[model samples]
Target: MKIIRSRSFTPSRAWGALEIANMNGITTRLHWTDQPYKWHVNDGEEVFAVLDGRVEMRYREDGIERSTVLETGDVFYASVGTEHVAHPLGAARVLVVETQGSV
Candidate 1:
């Protein structure tokens, strides 16, 4: 068993992540970032949870661009083929769950 303090976690570089678990091809991770990620589609479903700070989540829906602000404790769900990206308001900690090796 292990206890993780998400708020205190820090990454060596922007968008760096720490693997937490891998079960049945699904992976869970803790990520730290201060920069925005590039727009891309996940090969599978994803659950993104904000642990600290804030984030502006951008996505394309029906070919229209949209965005929403996610604060600490907010969660975002991205389904397969959903084009999206995350832009941290500053330094933030996030918990992400998705298929192993997915991009």
Candidate 2:
């Protein structure tokens, strides 16, 4: 067993991640980022949970762009084919769960 302190975790670079687990083709990771990610669609479902700081989650719904601010402890679920991007208000830690090798 392992104990992870999400708030204290830091990455060497923006958007860097630490792999936490891989079970039945599903992967869990902890990520640190201060920059915004590019808009893209996940090949499978994705769960993004903010552990620290804030994030502005932007997505496209029915070709209309929308966004929401996610604070610490907020979780965002992205279904397959959902176009989205994440812009952190500052340095933030996030827990992400998705299919292995998915982008």
The clash count of every prediction, one per candidate, is: 0, 0
Task: Output the worst ten-in-a-row residue range by lDDT, candidate 1.
Answer: 1-10
lDDT by residue (tens digit), candidate 2, 1-103 = 7799988888889889999999999999999999999999998999999999999999999999999999999999999899999999988899999999998
Candidate 2 ranges beyond 4 A from true positions: none
CA lDDT of 43 in candidate 1? 80
Superposition TM-score, candidate 1 onto the true structure = 0.97
lDDT of 2: 0.95
What are the lDDT scores of the predictions, listed in order? 0.94, 0.95
Ten contiguous residues with the weakest lDDT in model 2: 1-10
lDDT agreement of model 1 with the native? 0.94
Candidate 2, residue 84: how far the Cα is off, in Å: 0.1
TM-score of each: 0.97, 0.98
